[model samples]
Target: MTVVAPPTLAPPPPPGAYKDPKASAVASRAWRWLWLPLLILVLVIAGASVVFIVDLDSSDTGTLNPHSYRPDGGNALRVLTEQYGTPVDTPSTSADALKAGLGGDVTLLIPDTAPLSVRTIQSLKALPPSTRVVLLAPDRGALHVLFPDLDFGDFPATSPVAPNCDAPEAKAAGSIDFDGAGYLPKTIHAAHVTSCYQGGLLLVSDSTGPEFALLGDANLLTNEHLTGYGHAALGINLLSTHSRVEWLYLDQPESASSEGGDGSQALFPPWVDAASLYLILAGVLVALWQARRLGVPVPEPLPVVVRSAETVEGRARLYRRAGARKLAAESLRGGALARITPALGLGADPDPRALIIALAQRSGRTTQEIHRLLYSPPPTDDQGLLALATELDRLVDDYLTQLTIGRAGADQGNNPEGPQQ
Candidate 1:
């Protein structure tokens, strides 16, 4: 009996079979992410270029050259955030200062907006028990809960100066040419330091509740501003004097900061750990080998990264097309001989077959002596190269004598003695 045919169900349409206008709009909007951040970053950086130029060329900014910045120590903020333009606060401490005289807690704040972040609050709260709070620019009514008795001495934000440290750092302190220029102004009024509170940071110390030493200027830290500014010397003193120093580089816009370093002595790279002597030797060898090779010259310190497999693959394609298999084989053979012949102390250009014959002759080896080893056929494919290696290894024992003296009687020694009597 014949069966009746049934109708088949149609499959559901593929995802988004019909492009909804809303969905299309969303997809189009998503593509903007590919370039929007980059475009905005370019614009921002371009705009920031002016600040950089001002920091570099203007007087009272560059800390490296005495003429760049006035000897006034008051505008430390401008020196930090505007002058040198380095991300880290240059007014804080110098490396030498850190080693020579650094002492006590180093507190700093770069503030923005009225509402302090909870994380910042927690970090400030977590200061060591013996630390003191140092308010750079404390805004009135903003941190009333934290600093009720803060001494606001109404210090001026800036002071006039020559191209060097012109005054004592404090009433009792001696001034040092922190920047290249010898002139460093005496302590500017601390009010400038308190101003950062208007922005966001409230650098607090656990030891000193209210009367902490305040540095009003951040100009010493900016990359463009600090070069000629006495910023460098000021930092050195702080760093040298402090027992333990911490650098918290805050990204004001992001309300985030990162550590320049934590306590650690080893500056070695991770690759220094070698598993064995061979590994250590190999690593050293690789480095030495690389150092000797003069690759493409680069103006900067950045390395020239290469993909070996890709390069080889490209070369291999060319080789295969040109049918240079025989030439390739000869080149490999020459290399093998250079290594093997010298190792055995044989003639520099000793033929493999001739060397084998000489070994057989010295030991009085019969035609049947290791016949399989000597007469083994070369493989037909690319694997033929392996046969040459395997046979060479097998003959090394019989040919040792040939390498040292001369192979005159190796074949007889290796031959099966007539009957084993």
Candidate 2:
């Protein structure tokens, strides 16, 4: 008996089912080589981050803090003063410095006043007359805030220059790092402003505010240059003359007006956060507009019909490609059993034991053997799966033939008038 599959037309599977086996193999191979590059990229980024942090901590830039061990830091000064029984207190903000330097003899030392705001400068200027305020490299804005009449002027190259006149700190250091910008007062307040460098004074003391000392250059205060010439002596005499030193390391201000001249642009840049929000909102709206359903789908007839033989061949190829021999074997056995059960006059949901018993009795085969063939573990390979499918078909066809012959013989017996033509 022959079991031939007829032509059958059915809808194609969903798009996801049509994956190419070659493409999957290529993707797996690509990942094998690609992971190394990704790892290298990550390592490169990490190395760059480490270098940036190191560069930021370097003392060549103007950053003075006792906590920092960088070349520009005041760690040496801080340690020296502590040894001499003078403790240095470092404050981050202007308000904190004022509160710390409330005593009349306290010296408020500002390493870099470029970061100070108009508000902080005003607050610093309001300190007591007895409390000395030391400023290093005060810019135009700072000079304007501290000394309203003083103007920035062109100065000669910094050199080891004498005090030339009697100022106690300058005379003590003898020669110092005086190479920097100078201040030119609109009106010569001779008693108040004392010029030390050349044309403009390296150190200035204004009478309007506290005993404010304005030094031209900041390099002299750094850890690298502190030991050069009279730098250390100058720094110590200038800062540690008082009992306590209030070190104010004013970083960039938080408020907009303190940074950019234009308040609106500094506070809220038009192209940054605001633009990003608008872009995100626009993208969401576009997605919603495109995704909205217009109407229900209409069913349409397929353009071409695919034969069952071709479909079966395609499915077999797919199963082999996926290494699905076991799945293929199970499907074939199930199909054979479905056809055979009905031929034996059994219901669709007949018990498996009963069906096996009926098949065994009719074919004169052992119940165990029939059960093993009908409901056994799936085949391990493609050759084994093909053999199982052929065996199932032969067994089912033979049983069906026997059942047909038995029905014919029973009809002849009931009529008793011989076989009807």
Question: Top lDDT: which candidate number?
Answer: 2
lDDT of residue 390 for candidate 2? 83
Could you give candidate 1's per-residue lDDT for residues 136-165 as a string of tens digits?
333444344344455443333233222222
Per-residue accuracy of model 2 over 1-421 as CA lDDT, tens digit each: 2233322323323334333323444675698889999999999999999999997765333467766667787788777777777778887556678776665678898877777777677777667767888888777787776667776778666566667757787778777656788766444454566666553344544555567777777777778888888887777877777788888875555352542244446567667878888999999999999999789888898789989999999999999999977557666766777777776677876666667667776665566666667666667877778788888887887777766767776676688776569
Candidate 1 off by > 4 Å: 1-119, 122-126, 132-135, 138-145, 149-211, 220-231, 252-421
Every model's TM-score:
0.25, 0.50
List the lowest-lDDT window of 10 residues for candidate 2.
Answer: 1-10
Report, for every candidate in turn, its global Cα lDDT versus the true structure: 0.39, 0.70
What is the model-wide C-alpha lDDT for candidate 2?
0.70
